[model samples]
Target: MRTTNFDFSPLFRSSIGFDRMLNALEAASRAETMDDWPPYNIAKTSDDDYRITMAVAGFSQDELDLTQNQNMLIVSGQKANAEDGEYLHHGIGGQAFQRRFELADHVKIMGASLVNGLLTIDLKRELPEEMKPHRIAISTDSALPESETKRIDTANQAA
Candidate 1:
């Protein structure tokens, strides 16, 4: 078996708090094979907003489960037992499956809906007020007194 190794050093240099995302990517690369059952689609609706849609044809809302734990979003489904008649050929897939998604910091699950056999999950990134960048007002020489201006000049000179 071929093992793929991912180098996340360069990504770590530019990103501040994305260790889990990079680690998740590396872990995904190391996975032996990709599971395509119950296919899903991830789309960015707008800046800081995302959506994940999966084709869960036979599973209802009660049979499906959605859980958000820290940085992980898990979606699983298990079909309830149903009366089986004589089937010529069962093509529709309803096997139990679980899918895990790695979410970035500040990304929250806004809502989820199951419609037309498609399960859609909405996510939005809401940065805290402290985390958002704010302009720092500069003290001009005219705004401050002589003593304060002198301190500002001294600080600038020292820098």
Candidate 2:
């Protein structure tokens, strides 16, 4: 495999606490060059919801495994056994495969289902209350002491 050197000095200088992000990006770029077996699609179902569907034909739900560790989601499949009959020309692939997806912060897998040979995994981003955007109430009334207010007024008048 051909390797390319990327200069992250500029990014490192400007951003803090993003080492994981940069590493994930590098890993993703490397993984992108590999063959795409069992094609998949990531779709946004709602503002904070997403669904990832993979073509896992011939693999039973029990033969597949899904796991989430930190920010990574891993999916793997292995057929229990080959079909009893021999195939003259086998075309349908039921090979063992593994796929990994990097999840963003606050993203969590909601559920997963297998239907019609497709494995769909749902995800939702739920930000904590402290992380969510909030509006601070602005005070219209002054809370300064009378003496302090008089001093400010006198200073403004003198100016």
Candidate 3:
């Protein structure tokens, strides 16, 4: 693996609470080529709904594993049995595979299903009440009872 370094000090001067984004960018810069096996597709079914479809032929539900940890999703598959025989042409790929996905905040896996050599995983982003945006109403002096506003009396203070 090759090592690469980047200076993000200039960006930090005007940005706040963006350290994680910078770190993610640096990590992506150093990441190597991803494996092409077990090709998958990610789609946005709705505003907050997502789906990940992976083609895992010759793998049963029991042979496949799916797990989520923090902000990461992992999917792996292994064949239960392997036949040692000479074949003229081997078409379908039955080798073991492990794939990872980086999930965003507030995203959760709804469910998963396997059918017809395809493994589909459903995901949804459900924001918490505290995280959702709220509208703030502005107030005017006429809308409130008349009350004397506090003032700093400079004359009453000692020099």
Per-residue lDDT tens digits for candidate 3, residues 1-159, read 667677777887889988777777777777789889999999999999999999998899999999999988999998988677988998889889999988888899999999999999999999999889999999887776556555689999997
Q: After superposition, how far is residue 20 of candidate 3 from its true place, in Å?
A: 2.7
- The per-candidate count of clashes, in order, stands at 0, 0, 0
Off by over 4 Å in 2: 1-5, 141-159
Q: Write the per-residue lDDT of candidate 2 for residues 23-140, one digit (tens) a residue.
A: 7766655654766899999999999999999999999999999999998999999999856797899888888999989899999999999999999999999999999899997754
Positional deviation of 61 in candidate 3, in angstroms? 0.5
- The lDDT of model 1 is 0.91
Best by TM-score: 2
| Model 3, residue pairs in steric clash | none
| Model 2 TM-score, 2 decimals | 0.82
Which segments of candidate 1 are over 4 A away from where they belong?
Answer: 1-3, 7-18, 145-159
**Every candidate's lDDT:** 0.91, 0.89, 0.90
